[model samples]
Target: MNIQEYIESGILEQYALGELDDAQRAQVERMATEHPEVQAELEDVQRALNAYGEAHALTPPPGMKERVLANWQAAIQSEPGQAPAAPATEPVVRQLTPPRSEPAAAEIAPSRVSWSMAAAVALLLLSAAANLVFYNKWKQAENDLAVAQNQQASLASTMQAVNKNLTYRNQELAVLRSEQFKTVALLGTPAAPDARARVLYNPTTKAVYLDVRKLPAPPSGKQYQLWALDQGKPVDAGTLAAATVAGDSLQQMKDIASAQAFAMTVENEGGSPTPTLSTMTVLGKM
Candidate 1:
């Protein structure tokens, strides 16, 4: 099988868990030794499982050592050469007794056994609980990683769509540029001598390219309004945003008739019903 297919076959997980039989384990180990990538994947899986196990080890029972010692002592006593007396049902409580004090050892043996058994059961339960918690945490992390990967794929798709749209728009702009387009340079006026703009008007197609690259940004509550002037009176064209100053061109509406000049003024956000003639920034004649 291919490396990717082998990795996906669940054998790696089984190997990590040590669930494979002897022959299968040897085969996996041999493959891992031969393939660095497989080795790395195996190491990662093993490390994760090892960490989970360490975080969930069972604690030995309380007084287990004493109980085992008591049982060993009894076994030794039962032997022919040994002389130590067999401990009683309840071994002496040495924890509360002075070492020098002579007490019946069997008095506390049963209590020790009981305590040891209880502690052993408790430790087993705690180990099980810890294992379950670690398993859940691992599952949750895996789920989160899957979700993030899915989101990344979605974002990549969206970017591809946006790039396609931009390419189409650029093609359309090239077509427009090829037609009967007239370029009009709008000079900065006295009120704002630093601001300038250009209008690329295609009379045949009735399309306008308003390039406002040299224009200053409008105030927060206002935008720049374009007008098509006939004689001395100006006709409303369309509004442009502050983004127009950042080298991004704006496409205005089409079909302007008998326009002798173009002018721009700062007006309210939606633009004024009439041009704010006093705040005019740039003006240009056709």
Candidate 2:
């Protein structure tokens, strides 16, 4: 098969994941040996996957190695024709002896010790590498878990904010339906013909519910300002940020009294001292 077809067959991914059957694995190994490009690509995929696995590895439970070694020794002892098992508390060491007659005294001791030390150092290095790899994998998994937890917390916070807003709006709607309350619909102005708002005023409780759902998002460094107006002169009710624009409803001001009408205008953040007539979006009479 061509390289593209070979890659598209999904065998490479399986090989990287160590899921291939023995026959398929042998074939891939043979091919990798024969083709340098194939070998390079295989190595790249394997390295990437290994890195990912390492990044998400979990620590093995303690005492596992001891358990594994104990089982192995038990199995070895149970084998037919095997030597008798050694005592559990006794230390066992295997010694290698060279033929003594022709060997020089100086060469024998140093060479043997040197070879043994070299073997020990090599084993130590391999063990260290393995331990480092395992540690890195465990740390990576912990970091990933922490990040996932943080994301879940952020989503929960957002949901709580939404729920709180919904509860507040429902309470306002309930008050508006009461006998002592007055409802007023605000029509869109010439500056923004598609926009509209509503005001539910409770005279008994002196609360005003202003819904500015239809208003557009204000420009950067600007905000939507609500005005409680009497005879064209305006009183600052509240200022709304861009986040309030796309939501279903907004509770801009509460506990308002002695206002004849309500109006909205686009103005600087924290609102202007008075409504900017030219930028007015909605107007309503109570």
Candidate 3:
């Protein structure tokens, strides 16, 4: 639909030369009617064709007129007695040769050259149009490939997220359904009324699992630690971050046995040897 490209397309030239088929000619006609530039270009091409034909116009031979006149007089004299008389000898075949003349040879040379020029122009235009078609097709293919790649990447991300969630859920189910594990809840303290955590413990193996369900993320360079109280003394149960992420719930912590209570406290990066009672965010007595 690019007018400039269409204008330079040489379709007008082909139209002037009467080289295009009916459908193509109709299409060019529609274009010419709709676009003034196309119409003007068609007129220009027509004028050029006319100019070429005039410049190379061929004339009849000098003997051609005399020969035709002689034939006509002989026929008239023979036919005077009766109706139009037949020729004494009928011509067997028509002549296909052109008259020999210097002017005619010059005219023929120009005509042949013009034909070659027209053919070359037409061939060049066809090549250009074909290239445009192939270019458009190549661009469409590239766009389709890009869309497919994006869709595939999106599908891959979705699958990865689903698998991660499934893995987390399976781990949770394993701990929840096991008879050897016991569940414990850490209620929010007065210091952090909204904080809460859960613990899963196996008494036989002293394995501990911590899930911080509702707790604020620890400040930079600080972490949360768990302590098990046995005989009124604090024991290092485990350490973990205070933040929770999707597909990540329970964190494995140090094991404990024979604990009377479990508590969580916020401390510096490595954690303290003893519990910071004032910072205790949650506590649950077994």
| 1-286 per-residue lDDT for model 1 (tens digits) | 9987888898999988879999999999999999998999999999999999999998779999778767865775478355345566225533554333323565578878988999999999999999999999999999999999999999999999999879867854874566577877899999889887888777777677677758777778888888988888888878885555665655654467657789998899887889988999999998
Error of 3 at 204 (Å): 2.6
TM-score for candidate 3: 0.57
- TM-score per prediction, in order, is 0.49, 0.45, 0.57
Model 1 residue 40 CA deviation in Å? 86
Of the candidates shown, which would achieve the greatest lDDT relative to the real structure? 3
In terms of TM-score, the best-performing candidate is 3
Please give, for residues 1-286, the per-residue lDDT of candidate 2 as tens digits: 8876786687878888889999999998887898787788889899999899899988778999668766865775588346445655233321232223224454879989999999999999999999999999999999999999999999999999989977987886677567777877888898888888787777777777676658777788888888888676788878764655665565647466668888889998878887888998988897
> Measured by TM-score, how close is model 1 to the native structure?
0.49
Ranking by TM-score: 3, 1, 2
Ten-residue region with minimum lDDT total, candidate 2? 93-102
Q: Higher-lDDT candidate among 2 and 3? A: 3
What would the per-residue lDDT of candidate 3 be over residues 1-286, giving only the tens digit for each residue?
A: 6988997887788788889999999999999899998888889889988999999988878899778766865775577666334564223211232233434675888899999999999999999999999999999999999999999999999999999989977987898788988888998899889888888888898988887778767777877888988899999886785434111578778988778788988888888898888888889877
Task: Count clashes in each candidate, considering only residues at least 3 apart in sequence or on different chains.
Answer: 10, 0, 0
Clashing pairs in 1: 88-106, 90-106, 90-107, 90-108, 90-109, 91-106, 91-107, 91-108, 91-109, 92-108
Query: Would you give me the overall lDDT of model 2?
Result: 0.78
Ranking by lDDT: 3, 1, 2
42: Cα error in model 1, Å: 81
lDDT of 1 at 43: 91
Clashes of 1: 10
